[model samples]
Target: MPFAGFYAAAPFAWRVSHLASDFAMAWFKGWSQKDQRRSRTVLLSGVAGLAFIGVTMKRVPPGHVGLIEDWRGQLLPGMYDDSGTHWVLPIVQHPVSVRVYPVKKKLVKEFTTKDGKPVEVMLQMKMAPKIYYVPEIYLRFGRDYGRSFLEQEGAIDVNSVVSQHTFDELVGDNADTEDIVDEIVSRIEDAAFFHKIKLRDPNIVFRDPNADDDEGP
Candidate 1:
């Protein structure tokens, strides 16, 4: 009888142990589901936030051109007091480049050579916008003039460069026509003083000449 009771108690203990394990496993599964749901929600929210930020960045669209940098190192639409990227009211402003130019010029003018003979002079100068002159040049000439700062100015830009004294200065054989031109250029540069243009080295090509016939004026 005691042996029979022992066998019967073994089955009872096994059933209780199995039931306890089942209950623990079910509770564990419930907890896991809650944590998984929370993690998924957090991940989705992060993705959405990143997407929103990317869209905003793309939408920034460049604003009104507070300043523009040209190929010649000149700024257009006018020069700026400061340099680097700038910010402005949205839709109120933006920047754009309208013109770009190389660093070279061809000029023609009439003047008295050293011998007091009237002659036509031609010049070819290789230049670029001075890093310093952009602001003033843009303000005065606007973007168009700033684009080809020399072109817009042209020869007439220095209307009085060849002064009455220019002829006299060349008459005494003390100064050559080229030297006089240099003086005129110096004065023009001094007067305008636009920082945008660089009057680098100049090459003189005598385009044409009318002999004085060796006759005294």
Candidate 2:
């Protein structure tokens, strides 16, 4: 078999299935000693390049919200790959999973009433990469946003959005707290801009904000 064929075959074996892992140690060694080391070097170099590219740089999508990282599953936020190549080499597979924890949030808070009363306001923030943007979310945020949850200082910002309106709007019986939260979500949707997130109309209460059911309706 040609040397190319050998390299090709080396990546796939019936027993192990992933021959690339088997040859992972001396992956660069060529089939024939007579072959010029230069070609080996070049092929190895190409392999290295493709290996890195194969591991990274998902070629899936855009407008997503997630975390990104190098091979180690480290976190890299607000990052993107410049380019990617489609190599004829089978040493690596296409559609390799780009490590990505899809972006999502559930808002939970204790709202202080005008009388300085604390009311627990639990919100469910449903934000995910709009299908088309899942891969982009991974590329942008890395595997774990790159490390667990992001710093959602948006509370302050969300408060700002809340502050713009009246107390009645937020905690009003007629208005409903969930509707108020939905409004807050809309503000976030616009503020985030390129961030792909979905905000459902917030419901009135997570688990009955009423102090107790004993109170008459």
**Please, what are the lDDT tens digits per residue for candidate 1 over residues 1-217?**
8599889899999999999778756655756787867766886899898775554331212221235444554443553332244433233343433222335567666755444446455656665444445455556666544335444453543334444444445433554756656765675465335455656565554323444555578
Q: What is the lDDT of residue 52 in candidate 1?
A: 58
Q: Model 1 misses residue 101 by how many Å?
A: 10
What value of lDDT does candidate 1 attain over all alpha carbons?
A: 0.51
TM-scores for every candidate against the unseen true structure: 0.38, 0.38
RMSD of each: 22.5, 11.1
Model 2 is weakest, by summed lDDT over 10 consecutive residues, at 85-94
